[model samples]
Target: MTTFVSIGSLTGSIHPSLSGVLTKRKTVLNCPIHGDYEAEGIYLGSILKTQTKCPQCEEDQREAREAVEAVMRQEAIKKEVEERVAKSRVPLEYRTKSFDSFRVLNAEQGKALELSKRFVRGWEKAKAGGYGLLFLGSCGTGKTHLACSIVAALIANHQFLFPKYYRTSEIFSAVRKSYVPGSQTSEDEVLNYFSGIELLVIDEVGVQKGSDAERRILFSILDTRMTSNKPTILLSNLSAEGLCSLLGDRLYDRVRSKCVPALFVGQSMRKPATPDLFD
Candidate 1:
């Protein structure tokens, strides 16, 4: 014979120890479907155990889960709406111009823009999936404008999407100012915001000299996004060689792995246009 012990009893008359002994010897433990009903004396060691829902408990759990899911869905929708609004607010002139419109720009720049469009469109096809593109080129070559246009198209399609634009110098300075040895909450918040955005556009990369600590923050953000397969767009005057010079071999390698590197070649489009606008 084997000795067994019970834990507690539902009815006042039955001893908990006896209940445990019966449950241990006859009923199954940790059985979500049958354990509760079996303990109530509804099924006394029957070959086929019957399952009865605890109406109050079941309803409560169901309602709680529904409440959480409802809130999450609402938050997602709200975020999407906000992104659309922000993108819409960008000037029409900036958003309308695309790779095709810039006649002065070279074929490589046009190809780069097409690649970027494909990357963004691919993300829309898989909304839940995170992916990103990086545009590495000198200033005045329409990197920012193209990024904004892509965001505009996504918003126009009424997709749940958003683009977050940041200057590398701004990020570097903010991360540096927030550092106080152990306090990284501000830095974490920045990283969290960056990670959640559907697209991240970083302009003027290598514009600022980064300390070791600053580089660490940048690495953390990039690593987390890369691991999550989120899309990132980098706009810089630096070439691939220049990036290697600035960010070092290790970090440059990480960036190269995710990005389809493209060179933007042209006279500075930001310069005052000639009388004909194309000369």
Candidate 2:
């Protein structure tokens, strides 16, 4: 006699005798997708009867699970990027600035942002010939804002890079700390650490006077990273000529040879808190 599995009876309120019969030799199932198969099906609670789901159906379920996992992994990566961008800034002012909050009220600012975005998109290609970005202008022109926005965009979009940001003074401060006796961190170690980053951002390029030692340290950083095809971004309240004077030809030459320039000429973005200063 042909055997048939009453899926509803097996999955529904089970009689005591049904349980005894089920525990015996495996029951056979006839599914539309896989024809006949032997099953030692698990007792699913009142909600579902998957006795019809044969080995082929289980394979389909496995594929569905893998697809969901892939989507979850992508979301995790994006969340990590957002977190790192929030924490990357050294100055507190630009920490919260994002591309959305940045105002593009004029064409120059718009172009600056456009170029910054292009830099982020072509970053993988930069590792061969190297790419540098120089943001030059007076204070409050949003050069630093645009540069920070690039970092946020890059972290959100790319997986390989972890970038660092430093003001010109911070670069000196960081090196000075390494000079302390028994600190176990040498000056070369500090320079090498910054140089090895996938992207290095230095702000306020001409903010202070530079010494021969400072120049050597800075040159070592830019030269090492450039030869390895790493990218760097420099922000300043100075023009190209001003930076040339501030960093000197040896260092300035390296910057000029590799970097793309953006000039910002406007009133400071940092305004007085009083309303009258604006009006």
Candidate 3:
């Protein structure tokens, strides 16, 4: 059982069996809100020092510490995501694009916005199914805008998704550079890097010369990604037929199998700045 004992002006409770070995004391202390309470004091070899901590106060301190730790953990995750975004190589101009900032000037733009948001909302399902999107239309039609928005949303919300954004020309350029004499990188290395990304967005698809070499380079990356069930986004100014010719029958079939077309039709959002001659 338990027994309560008084040591000078303090009171403490201990089991009778521990009376000889353990020295425990308690002092009557007044808490601002809890009123009078007994503060437990323990004596080792030195004089006993009373710790005036109320039970309720300790609980409050514990909760505060937990809240601080939670905030710190959130900050760490945010930092990690930011670093990954930096390494993603998103173009500086499109880095700030998001669904909220996309302009909805026409019915098609509105539909495109809704589709992009749904894609982000169903990211897990899309990733599992190897589904992707094709942003097709004329240049300045906000194709790249929506593409970057999708990538930005995924990176911000899904920490596990690693996304890469590059122009079709950039990929071709990288592959060509890899062939230079004494080049540190190889063509296979370049293709493998593009193929291994969880999500890849290739912009300006039809800008490159339709050389057989370019076609082969594009085909190799797409084929590998398709086989691995990785999702891809292609931003292009070509019509459906035009893009089909560029990708050829076999490669186009693979893209159509997993990618949904988000047609962005309308005037280019870019407007030339009028000159202020008088100024």
lDDT of 3: 0.84
lDDT of 3 at 68: 100
> What's the TM-score of every candidate structure?
0.58, 0.72, 0.78
lDDT agreement of model 2 with the native: 0.77
Q: Where does model 1 exceed 4 Å of error?
A: 1-101, 125-130, 176-185, 273-279
Per-structure clash totals for the candidates: 4, 1, 0
| Tens digits of per-residue lDDT for model 2, 1-279 | 224444433535767545422222246777798788776544433223344448778988899999999999989987887778766763567766777787876777888888887887787776556887999988888898888888888877766667888887888888989989888899888988888887889988777677887777777888887777788898988888888887778778887778898888767778668868668
Q: What shift in Å separates residue 242 of candidate 3 from its native position after superposition?
A: 2.0
The digit string of per-residue lDDT tens for model 3 on 85-179 reads 66787877877778888889899889888988898898898889888898888878888888888887888897677899999989999999999
Q: How many backbone clashes does candidate 1 have?
A: 4
Worst 10 residues of 2 by lDDT: 17-26
Candidate 1, overall lDDT?
0.64
Supply the TM-score for candidate 3: 0.78
Off by over 4 Å in 2: 1-16, 19-78, 275-279
Tens digit per residue, CA lDDT, model 1, 1-279? 322344333466766543322233333334454344222323323212344445556777899999999999989976765556565444445655554565446887778778767865676543444445567676677777777766665664555555666777777766655576776567677767766666677777777675676677677777777667776777788877887876678767777777667778776787675799666
TM-score-best of 1 and 3? 3
